[model samples]
Target: MAGHDLGFQVVYRGETLEYYRPGGWVFFQRPKDCGGGYWLGRTYDGVFMIEYERPVSLSDGMDFLASMKKVEAKSEEFDPNYSLF
Candidate 1:
């Protein structure tokens, strides 16, 4: 971790870089030592503001995730005679 200037080094999911672009969000996964692996995530709404900040912690990460909307995928209806074409 020497010479690493990042606030917190994240494993960087494939989509993590998306946040650099407009209309994208990013999430960072904590190391095992950081409370058995939890996620520290944030959505980039492209807005700037000033507010309080604190050192990242597992409990805080879980609380943040809890406030964010959960993602769910929709499944297609099952069909006995569905065509592959």
Candidate 2:
């Protein structure tokens, strides 16, 4: 979580997605390989990462992620460091 700050890079499959932290909200675009769209990125705070249903524009995805939030089983409950969403 070192680069969770605004404009930090989130890397997946060698692809890079930029993240933004406005106020206490952290959002990042999901890699296409993992299914594209923006997600409510993980935070050091209590907020858990949220996934999107369909691919979306980065700005719109970020804006709507909270409302689109889904319930996911906590990683620590079943599999360590593994979130099922």
- Candidate of highest TM-score: 2
Tell me the tens digit of each residue's lDDT in model 1 across 25-59. 23354445654443433334664221114334444
lDDT of 2 by residue, 1-85 (tens): 3334433334433443343343233445566777775554445443445444454555665455434333322323555686677
Give stretches of model 2 more than 4 Å off.
Answer: 1-23, 41-56, 62-85
Query: How do all models score by TM-score?
Result: 0.25, 0.31
lDDT of each: 0.37, 0.46
Candidate that scores best on lDDT: 2
Off by over 4 Å in 1: 1-19, 43-85
* Model 1 / residue 64 / CA error / Å: 11
